[model samples]
Target: MVKVRLWGSLRQAAEGQTEVEVEARTFKELLDRLVETYPGLAPQIARGVSLSLDGVIYREAWFTEIRPESEVVLMPYMTGG
Candidate 1:
């Protein structure tokens, strides 16, 4: 199981949960499982989000490998005004 930390709006979508556990081998699979477990997150996820794995941020790394102990964080896309 991977530990996923939800931030900002993503946390709101997940019913205020800051952390969640999911079983997946890859980043893409994690997202799939997340949406499956938390249907409310689908719309926010579809809008676009950034992922941080072991402190490294990724935007389009769907194939990134994720281990059971990996530290993962999910947050809404960041932009500058």
Candidate 2:
């Protein structure tokens, strides 16, 4: 199980728990697990949310694999004009 930390508005979706545990082999899997664990978070977690693994930002496609002991942070998207 990987430990996932929720931030900002996501904390609300996660029932105000700053941290959660998810079973996953990849970052994508983590999202899938999160949604399954907390159905209410699906829509929010899907909107270009970025992930950080062990405190390092992970880019697209980098989510293909995950470390078993990794700690992930889910952050809302940042949009610019």
In each prediction, how many residue pairs overlap at the backbone (N, C-alpha, C within less than 3 A)? 0, 0
lDDT of 2 at 28: 80
Query: Which model scores highest in lDDT?
Result: 1
lDDT of each residue in 2-51, candidate 1, tens digit only: 88999998888888899999999987898899999999999988988889
Worst lDDT run of 10 residues, candidate 2, spans 55-64
Off by over 4 Å in 2: none
- On the 0 to 100 scale, the lDDT of residue 63 in model 1 is 96
